[model samples]
Target: MPLHLPHLRSVINSDGAAIFDAEQGTLTTLNATGAMLWRGIEQGHSKEQLLQSLADATQLPEEQLRLDIEEFLEQLTAQHLITSE
Candidate 1:
């Protein structure tokens, strides 16, 4: 099955970011770049979608964002903020 990200609830702050799972009582932190990508996700963005969006928003190339994008997705997925579907 494909991973999905629609079940998450997120909030942004000056210091960092938070993705919360109400059922689990868990909260995750996002670094500067991770915060950017997490905030960019809306209705439809895959891991690649986040990478491209981050590149465009930061004026960086997709290749430059690739590794970080993959890492971010990993963290999100590990925490159930996103799915692997």
Candidate 2:
């Protein structure tokens, strides 16, 4: 699946990222890890590429990272912050 963000504005920093949904008038803050994932999504990375890249960067197991990514995706979907294609 591919992910898409609609009407969102974001600012990323060394510490984290802050995303604003202009349509919903809501703000979301993400930690460093989340920010990395968000950036990957913005770059149009596939789920597998994201998992592998994050695993290499963090030296974490791919299985755990996959679960984490899935959970994060679910949260974004639930919040209507992203749509999948």
Best by TM-score: 2
What is the Å distance of residue 32 in model 1 from its true position? 3.6
Model 1 scores a C-alpha lDDT of: 0.69
Which residue ranges in model 1 land beyond 4 Å of their true spot? 1-7, 13-15
User: Which 10-residue span in candidate 1 carries the lowest summed lDDT?
Assistant: 1-10
Per-residue lDDT tens digits of candidate 1, residues 1-85? 2243545678887666888777677878877777777666544566667767777778876776888777767766777776654
CA lDDT of every candidate: 0.69, 0.86
* Tens-place lDDT digits, model 2, residues 36-68: 888888888998988988898899888899999
What TM-score does prediction 2 earn?
0.93
Clashing pairs in 2: none
TM-score of 1: 0.69
